[model samples]
Target: MVYDEHESTARFLLPATGVTIDILPGSEIEVEVIYREIFEDGVYCKHGRNVADRMKDEAGAGGSKQVMNVKALLNVALGDRVCAAGVPFTLFPRHPGNSTLNPEERIRVQRGIVEPYFFEGARQYVVPMTTLSDVMEERGIERVDILKVDVEGAELMVLKGVQDVHWSRISQVVMEVPDIDEEIYTEGTIASVKRVLLITQLLKKHGFMVITEFDPNGKNHMVYARRI
Candidate 1:
């Protein structure tokens, strides 16, 4: 199953993935409203500004299994919020959901200076938010043999929401937790090494043997976990 809030890009890129990823109109973007913001394109650099475009141009490989596309923002908590492409004021996945964020880190994110690689954009839209556990229960999903997650920096939030699913159903997990997360490594926490331990520890707590030998992007480690 594939879950992405942006319908147009999701359908456009995963055309052959085989699922109904219809482009939801702007008004149909959310079921529950969160907050609203009108942003000015304050791009700091070209690299950061075009990050979203780059993702669209580079579609990931898909498996042969049947795919079900759901248009909703994946978060630990569910809500209706703005989720736009190239917009820095939102999609702060690096946020650890904790107060560990230093002043500098907080400032950068607040000013739309941290994500999309720190580039601000002009697009804006609301995204219906939901969690994996909620979706599983809603769909009556009982088992997931292999789970793969790569959400820039919201890896922990997604995993945390798995709850019973991770403990009972999922047999193996392959994910990429971006080590560049500013919130993942906080005060006195080393960014390079300790960041990975956080993921290893989480899986271990859930009765999984973990491995991280394949890190395609040196900054983001691809973690493999199997029920022991």
Candidate 2:
């Protein structure tokens, strides 16, 4: 299930064994069985276990259990939060890491090129994710109305460093969660969907509502959020 907190309520998306439901009003609604099977083709066995076998095993050994596809489940929960908030937001691009480019180019650009381009737009300042916290501190930024974070595979790390900061002041966040692709960064590895869930949980805990998610063909998956 996905839940996002908005100004006064929450949005929800729930996916059951063979169905998916989108809830925008934070209230229950009756849905027919037909709507539940809209994307039956995408369903599959988990961990090599066929559906029947899994069900039989569960039935035999049942107490109360919650088995889920982490990625899909997280998406649903995030969707819920977004529906409640009723906010509009956009996703940001992925941040290219130093390992993605040649050492000389990375150094030259880090020290020489980025500054000019970062300041070219009004209310926009681009900097490496690793240095974001430092930049915020140096700039005396006590509040961030909107934040766009895309730090390649280092998104989790960047978020980790600022977990305890005053994130309530942040009205929006658009972050890219890296996927498996060495072409982008030598250090890149397959980021678990569970890790993404943790990040979303953190944001939700701080009163931010995920508003939307974008899965573009040639780019990293993005999660967009706004403050409750």
Candidate 3:
């Protein structure tokens, strides 16, 4: 069996070596192999960025942390108006829920699966999954404290949109980085380990400190970070 240099797919040069290795082209094998390779090498491994370095960069940013999740934002507000760095701001819930059913149910019915609830709160703004940076820029908010993103598998796109944002005020971030294999391949979503690693590196360069991570029971991983 041979894996490609890009690591996108593994080909079985010679049939089973009696090892019966499940050759899941874009599945668990991909995640394990990529992760192991990165672990063995340093930051600039075959992948790219390591978790530790990314966290450090996030911490060093000077921006006002913007909590992307509506529930989290509400919790921070605590009955008081939303304010970051003395700058009064409005809370924007990207995908708000409807009154007919729970948010989780709404998402599940929309996706045709019993998935977890990601967004909650009043309908403030219905932004596309890939236009986070555009929303922020349009709002004219200079400093974003923490962007608590939990968009099922659209994290990569969201991160991509904000690639040019000033990292100083966008200090901290907490996102759910789903299992590349399960979420993307198995579930037929547009997620990949390569994309995740790319976004991780971008965050690292900006000064965020990736602190905690929760692996999916059998599906995804949640990465939490803070600005130093």
Q: Which candidate tops TM-score?
A: 1
- Please tell me which model should have the higher lDDT, number 2 or number 3: 3
Give the poorly placed runs of model 1, Cα more than 4 Å off: 1-122, 181-193, 214-218
Q: For model 1, what is the alpha-carbon lDDT of residue 45?
A: 14
Model 3, residue 66: distance off in Å is 19
Please write out the lDDT profile of model 2 over residues 86-168, one tens digit for every residue: 32221111111222212232333344423433222122122122234554565677766446554434455556556357565
Q: Cα lDDT for residue 182, model 2?
A: 25
Q: Highest lDDT among the candidates is held by which one? A: 1
- The C-alpha stretches of model 2 lying farther than 4 A from their native spots are 1-131, 180-193, 212-216
| For model 3, the run of ten residues with the poorest summed lDDT | 72-81
TM-score for all models, in order of appearance: 0.47, 0.37, 0.39
What is candidate 2's TM-score against the reference?
0.37
CA lDDT of every candidate: 0.47, 0.42, 0.43
lDDT-based ranking, best first? 1, 3, 2
Candidate 1 per-residue lDDT over residues 1-228, each given as its tens digit: 122544443222222334454432332222111111111331111112222332344343343433444445443333122223212223322231211113333333334322443222223233345567776777777876566665545567667677654367876777755544434556978554545677789899999888775444334566778788
